[model samples]
Target: MGYSRGIGIVGLGVISRAYLETLVGHADVRIVAVADLDAERARAVAETVPGARALSVSELLADPEVDTVLNLTIPAAHAEIAHGAISHGKNVYGEKPLTAVLDDARAVMASAAAAWVHVGCAPDTVLGTGVQTARAAIDAGHIGRPIAATAAFFSAGHESWHPNPHFYYLPGGGPLFDMGPYYLSALVHMLGPIVTVQGAGSRTRSVRTIGSGPREGETLDVEVATHVTGVLTHASGALSTVTFSFDAHASEAKPIEVHGEAGSLSVPDPNYFDGDVRISRGDGWELVPVSAGYEHGSRGVGLLDFAVGDAPARRASGELALHTLEVMTLLLESAETGERRRVSTAPERPEPVPLTTEAEWRRIADA
Candidate 1:
């Protein structure tokens, strides 16, 4: 597919800044337009990108110059924005979880298919060096057959730092939904799609107080589970014990660990793209040095690279987004029903695009 000069970006929120910084300097992408509910916010962000105009969501969708619409809105609005973009004949790149509701996600997928517009999601972080190196090692049988795995994401709460943390406790914003994509994406990349899930969940407290930021000491109501634990049965018959906790105290541990018959691999925090991939053998865990050619601030650049044909479309595809949504939906289902939820979706394996040299890395990095 031929690359467009630039893509239009919607939602000029805090998360969109990282993407803007990366796009401004890239030769492959141009920031054509920016839209937000807050017109002032959209105008402010538009000032930074050359030839970019501020528009309402409707206006941006109507703009003939926009080939792809990058949806960076909150979880609640993801489905609406993606559907609108697809309906207007523009490809979509949305933030994680795809949508808060399973039906909405399926609807968005169906819309993208009928429109023949490419639909993809974020947390393409797994495509970075950290997770990719681990995947390569596992695929080479360096870890032998996988046996079991464990992953955890624990935090005090988002009320402390996020400007609007009320939504963090909402349906799609809890620890599991908020941070689960990062961990789960890495897990699936290494272990394949999960087949079944059995779990338990609870809300430790109904109300939480903000610890910092302007809302410090302010109280907020929590509607979703603050603590959750589950067992995931992978297609390979490997079982993974996963836990997500928003009520817990601080802890110092990598969020994911995969155990195989021969050895184990420790993945760095998936929230960010680049980190070390450690391996365990006769000696204790040894850090496997792998360099992610891309810089840290370019969070969404990898996906943009894939989209523009500057690099191979190794990640950030719609199938992966659907699989991630499936895993998350079933986790919640199992917790609510107190029974093992069987997943009907299967994993789709894309041919591996080799990144064996510095030049290969440069092709993606420099682009």
Candidate 2:
């Protein structure tokens, strides 16, 4: 593929900054335009990039120069934004959980397919060193046959820091939907797809107060779960205990671990790329030194790979989006139905990509 000049970004929220910073110095990519419901936010982002214009969502989608639409809208707007982009013949790059609803996610996937445009989802953090390294070790049989795994995501609560914390408590924005993608994506990467799931979840508190930020001391009406715990049975016969929580207080550690018959692999926190990875061999776990690489904002890396023609078409395809949505939906379904939920669909695992190349690894590690 030829190099893409850049992609247009929609929704200039907190995450867009990271993508911009990462794209600025890269030869393969650029941000050619920006759009947000908030015009000021779009203009602010446009100011940072050369010749980049701030446009409305319609204008961004219609522009001939915009090859892909980066959909960073909130959870509620994800599917609609993606639908609009696909309708206008632009590929889409979306934030995690794909869409708030499973059926809508399927519709978006179908639309993208008919349009022949790609749709990629975020938490492409899985492509980073942390996940890649673990995948490589597992493929090399370093951990032996996978048997069981555990993943935990915990936060005091988002009300503490998010300027607008109300959305977080809504149906599409709880701990399971918000933070579950990173953990689920990592688990799928390491253990393959889950065939069955059983879960129990609840909101520990009826209302939460922001710990800090402008919203501090404000009360938020809780609509969805604050805590969730589930068991995932993978196609490979690995069973994983997964937990997501907004109510817990605990010391920070990596969010996931995959145990094999022989040993265990501890994954780095999935929120960022290039954290420490360790393998338990014999008596103790040994920290694996990360390879180096340029640390660009997370959103831009996949687009950068696309711009450089280094990745496949639909490289961040909608199918992965569907799979993630299915997993999350099942988790919630299991919690509500009081029965084990089976995930019929699973994300395809590409062949293991090694992290042995010093220069490439350094580029990712350093980044």
Candidate 3:
């Protein structure tokens, strides 16, 4: 099949499978190359993708036909891969947090700008119907004025099931850094940008035992907080109380809730693509219909959106990711210093995603 764009993926980790499933045979983008530190793994994956070749990371970055690099590297390697891709004059789309540190993320944005290449980041879950529907309701003033919100994501930790969960205990792997992107990105999409953050955190233990995987029974040192709680002050003056915990066994808290003058909105888990958004007025709760976003969206939809969308229309742009990173890192700093941290960046709210069905987006992709 003819394709409009070429995607060279760097990193064949666990997350790569999701992107592979989404982009491998898609009509709009071709998987031109696959690369990983484990050359065997890369070649194995490449063999499964029609017309795709396995190459070294450097080779993939310099490939003439590779228009964009799909970076699925670890957090620490995000900046390196992005810089390499930008230096090679290719657009890039990567998994969340943008980078392990805020300054690195800023550097990435600056580099991409100087190179005139587009950089898109994930937690594009916000571009899906679950979050977008809630965003639409707010934009339409169905909730009057958004005043406050609550975002909660609790889990025991990734070591329970993930084959390799050591990273979850590292600097960029805490609940907030690993999972905050989903909730925070969705919040920014719905409530606009954040201006300040106050945070507090706790660590339940210094070590975690691997419950599954080949490393089962092995212990991993915890280098960051396992439970993080914070209050984000948005540019719109709306406050959101958030609690992200890897220490918790479970919780019944809704993934997100926005309380406004007219009513309260129950947003679904921002990690997934779609869910029912409910609203509660004085008359009681009612289901808000799915009024926006790509129906049946997947992992690579953001990259596809980046490839097909005009610059101003890219909802998952690097600017948004950088701003999101600043918020998260600043929140961590605030937790350590016991002082509110002011956000340094203010990216404009992205253009809203209109209600687009699966068939519609598929047709658009094919074009």
Candidate 4:
């Protein structure tokens, strides 16, 4: 069978498994190569994939057969991997936040533009039925003019579950940067671009102990705020109150809620592909039928969307990722300075994903 695109993945971490599960043996794209800092790990992963070989990162980037670089590296390595791919004349798709810092994300965008290669980023969860249905409702005016929104995500932290959870406490690993993309990206899709933001945050603890790994009972220093809250002013004059916390134990807050002149919407968790989207219109809340987005979507769906789509038409384009990154970074910065910050990059809300089944998208991609 002929493959339309070739993917060379760099990074064999936990998240890479999810992408591989979603992409391997697919019809439209092929796993041509795999690379990681750990040569043995790369080879092990490659053995599980057909038509794929383990190569050094540099070799994989320069390989003629690779059309796109799947960067699953840590947040700090996002820009570096993207830059390498762009320099080698390949498209790039990666895990979220674009980069550890906003400036690096900007550089990546500039580099990709100059190279004329498309860039895509993750948290494509918004393209799923959960968030997309809510977006469709808003766009169709099922909820009148959107006026306000509230989004919250709180957790005790990842140390309890993840083996190597040190990054969760680092500069780019805080809850806001690490998980804000899901909620923020969903909000951006549901509402519009954000113009300004005001934020406040706190660091609940200076150190965290690893809970269940070989390194269990070990402790790591915390370098970022553990709890963060902010207000975003969307370009459409809508306000969204957001709270992201690694310090909180638990909360019953909806993942996202948007209020409009006519009604209200309770959006499901943006981290996953599908969930019930409830709407409240004068009466009580009712489940809005899944009206849009890809059905049974998963991690690499964004990459598949990127491959079969032109840059302008891609739902998970790099511009949206960069804007989301800026919003997150500025919000954290605002927390430190006790001031309101204006978001500079205003990418238009990505084109909405219509109700599409797995077979439909795959057929489109295969074509």
Instruction: Give each model a TM-score.
Output: 0.92, 0.91, 0.97, 0.97
Residues 116-186, candidate 2, lDDT per residue (tens digit)? 88778877676677877787778779889988888888888888778888879987888989888878877
Question: Per lDDT, what order, best first?
Answer: 3, 4, 1, 2
Each prediction's Cα lDDT score?
Answer: 0.79, 0.77, 0.91, 0.91
For candidate 1, report its TM-score.
0.92
lDDT of 4 at 212: 98
Residue 213 of candidate 2: its Cα lDDT? 75
Model 1 lDDT per residue over 1-367, tens place: 2454558898887888887766675555667999999999999888877789999999998789988888889889999999889888998888887888878988888888898878878787777677777777888887899999898998888787777788788888788888888888788888888888888888999998877877788888898988888999989899999888998889876688888889999987778767888899758978876743343424665556556743235466666777777888888888999989888767564334344343333333233
Per-residue lDDT tens digits for candidate 4, residues 343-366, read: 999999899888999887655332
lDDT of 1: 0.79
The C-alpha stretches of model 2 lying farther than 4 A from their native spots are: 251-254, 289-297, 306-315, 356-367
Sliding window of 10 residues with minimal summed lDDT for model 1: 358-367
Q: What is the lDDT of residue 259 in candidate 3?
A: 94
lDDT of 4: 0.91
